[model samples]
Target: MKIGELARRTGLSASRIRFYEASGLIEARRLGNGYRDYPEDAVQRLEVITCGQQAGFSLEEMRALTLEPTGGANRHERLLASLKGKVVEIEAMQARLAQSRTHLLALIAGIEGKPVDISCEENAQRLLARLRENDEPHSQAT
Candidate 1:
């Protein structure tokens, strides 16, 4: 299929499909006119990638999770370890999210009650700091 057909079938923009190709998440061949010609399986791969993204896996992580190397005996053990670690991280994140929600509720109630020495700016800064501290994996990108 051509890029346009793939985009329509996937419900994703052509540019986004191209970007995914550039990111090494999708592969395509060049047609006679130099347009991208995607294989039939590309649509399925795109669907899987989209599903993984919705489930919070980065492209790199998704690639690792989808690896199909020739019969590695330790694959199950590695996947188990990765999933277990992710579960623990997710649990910790849930706790932090609950705490943040509680804190935000308190802040809202305090503001509604006309707290004397508190300002919205100060509260916002505090909340932002708490969020950054609790965010997973300490990204250097931001």
Candidate 2:
């Protein structure tokens, strides 16, 4: 199939297909007339690339996920392992984000609870103290 047909079938632009080729995530052959020719299985490969990207895989990671390497079992194992690893990474990121959010909310509370008559410099000092306290070993929120 030509790039146009591939793009139509995959719902991707021609430039995107060309970019995948440039990134080494997909391959195309130059025909006698110099137009890029894709194999029938290119549709499946492009779908895998898109799916992997949607799941937060980098183009480098998608290359591994989409490549048709020799030894079918190795390919299957690699895919499964990569998926599990990605899940773990996402969980860790979620936890860190949650912790940071909690710390920010606490800081907001401290600032809001300050006395209305206090000078700005006094409020700043109070916030610095709160920060130092939060940064202690047992109280560290993030």
Point to the candidate with the largest TM-score.
2
In model 2, what is the error at residue 79, expressed in angstroms?
Answer: 1.6
Model 1 clash pairs? Answer: none
**Model 1: lowest-lDDT 10 consecutive positions:** 64-73
lDDT by residue for model 1 (1-142), tens: 9998999999999999998899877789898899888999889889978887886678887677665553576777776776787778789999999988987786676556654576877766765665566565767657
How does candidate 2 fare on TM-score?
0.84
Candidate 2 stretches with Cα past 4 Å from truth are: 68-71, 139-142
Question: How far in Å is the alpha carbon of 42 misplaced in model 1?
Answer: 0.8
Candidate maximizing lDDT: 2
Give the runs in model 1 whose Cα sits over 4 Å from its true position: 70-84, 114-142
lDDT of 2 by residue, 102-136 (tens): 88887788788888999867987988888877778
**lDDT, candidates in the order shown:** 0.79, 0.88
Per-candidate TM equals 0.68, 0.84
RMSD of each: 8.1, 3.1
